[model samples]
Target: MTAPSEPTDASAPSPGSPNGPGTLAWRNAVFAVFFISGLGLASWVARIPAVRDSLRLDTALVGVLIFGLSAGSVLGLVVAVRLLARFGAPRAMTISVATSSIGLVVVGAGATLLESAPVVFAGLAAVGLGMGSLDVMMNVEGAAAERAIRKTLMPLMHACFSLGTVVGALLGAAASALSVSVFWHLTAIAVLVFLIAVVAVRSIPELENTAETSAPGEPASTWRSRLRASLSVWADPGVLLIGAIVLGMTFAEGSANDWIALASVDGHGFSNTAGAIVFGVFVAAMTVGRVIGGPVIDRFGRVPVLRACAVIGVLGLLLFILAPNDFALYAGTVLWGVGASLGFPVGMSAAADDTRNSAARVSAVAMIGYFAFLVGPPVLGLLGQNWGILNALYLIVALMALAGLAAPAARERHRR
Candidate 1:
């Protein structure tokens, strides 16, 4: 409710805190926004089976439709460069949430009342578009809040996202078991998610602060300069290196999200329930790692932690790929989860370290990571068709090593 100002509260823990006087409120609000985002995401994913049945589509059709979401997400990130320059974080985040909410409703309507594959695909695209920009903005906001607190909060904040996904997945399961219709279910969740985002945005204090500024204490002209500045982040080798770190880690995480169960089932010869359980183990490991990561980062530092995680991930992934027994398989899954937990959030934090460049840098790094999420799975899928899923995952292991090589790029940005 207050504009950005000097902290008047003498009792404040830090001098000139970036969130002004309401840093705690802003931090909690950011947490809420991140949590609701996860809910919105999982709500759709959890209902895929029911949606497929309702739309009378085969797995092939569903794959094609899912491409719409991935494609839209990539496109949305491109749009985000301008939006961040034009609207800033709070407004852009709000718009993105609204877009995602409306897209969910459209998806619900298409799947239930209309039963048109094209309509559903369009809806998925919209959802992806909205959530994509949202992903960048929220991470930007998270990095801001982390700076305000003068500590490592991004990891725990991301853990909040993981927490949201777990809750959303459970509620969705409950809805399905109760025979809740997809239209009503997605529609209701959409409304809830939208409202949460709207309320959460009120506490953010960024305004158009980063929009007009090129870097800390540097300014840009009205239109062309801003556009050029935003695009220039793509050329910044530092940002690109950080992005590389994110790309490998995200590919590892996304692959797990898409293929862990199947890999466990077929490659390791686990039963259906066991495979699902293995995937669950991975999720739990990720959640735990994120929740604990803040103190670990603060105590040790970003570079060392990231390198260790990369090594752990590579080891875990190798075990999963070449596990000779049940113990090796499960351990690998958990280690992979732990290894992948901190890269995305930590990279965002690093990108946003110089507040002036935060928006463009965060968006660029996010684009790289998100692309891995959207594109990596399918690449692995095609490879898995011939080389086997276990072999396909080796690609991720090599990339993870690359990510390790790039970890130092995410160290604290030198202030000018």
Candidate 2:
């Protein structure tokens, strides 16, 4: 099959045109959103050990606690479409980001004051809810920006997320070493991220026209209509196939986020600070891969690039799992990062190929993709508790293989 056609500039106003400035602003704003989202989430991930220690939790309990985040995220996805419709991307993102920051502070407080697992779980659920909503809004904005600029940028935007995670992880490592309290560390980061989000969201352009809307004479959509509209996307084989591809890939990515640090600590006997640093390395590798992978995808097409990444990821996981020493572990982390890089962004792009149904389709695809997050941690936790954290990663290898099989779904359909 032929590669998808490059987007035409004809449909996009030039920088010299009146709409140009606003478009550029939105692009930058979306980038900031992606960055802060990654930062906030990573900040929480990086401090998992502290939280676990504070609660005196075992792997099984930790997994259950982590479930709260995913549960809240799923809840957010349920309402994100309506929220976007009512508030628009900028306002929605601002509210979501601020709320997520508050949740982070709460998490820190729970750890510091109460050392209560339930309280922490509740806070994390709040974080997840905000993050899930913010995630959809930012992607919607990213899709708009890509069309406006008439270029491929989704991967680069995701790279900004990885970069943010890198920064957050490094900060987390420092905080851990210095015996910085989780309460203070997370609280400070939350405040800073909230301030930045408030300023950045101002630049996001309106998204009322891009996604499908009600017919001219139709009454405003009811909750029933919106629910039906969302559920209907699952009936489309193409959209479902795209969702499947993303599901496996996101499992690979999210598994690393939730487990890699713990793996390094438990399996490799690394200190908590060292483990966080290793996670930072992983995020940094992912950032590099995404930065360079966009052009490769554009040139090679999505199918081949995705399949190749899956193969590489599998090898990385194996090496990390079976290797005898730190060298092999580090190498595996790099390969795994590269391998895990493309699937989610490419899947999002595929889902949004038709601008008319982009919002609904993207939401459907996100729900499937995020299912990995919801189910993966607890499953891996069980596996880790039964066998070992390192052994549990074999599951990711299997998932990556599944992702490769579904990569073809990401192939862009040639427009007639």
Scored by TM-score, the top model is 2
Which prediction has the highest lDDT against the true structure? 2
Cα RMSD of predicted structure 1: 5.8
lDDT tens per residue, model 2, 28-117: 887888898889989998999888888888888889988998888878766666777787777777888888998999999999888998
- Superposed Cα deviation of residue 285, candidate 1 (Å): 2.4
- Point out where model 1 deviates above 4 Å: 1-23, 47-63, 78-94, 108-116, 143-152, 173-185, 202-212, 221-239, 259-281, 321-330, 349-363, 384-391, 411-416
TM-score of each: 0.76, 0.89
Worst 10 residues of 2 by lDDT: 1-10
For every candidate in turn, the CA RMSD to the true structure comes to: 5.8, 4.4
RMSD of 2: 4.4
* Candidate 1 TM-score, C-alpha based: 0.76
Q: For candidate 1, give the lDDT of residue 73.
A: 77
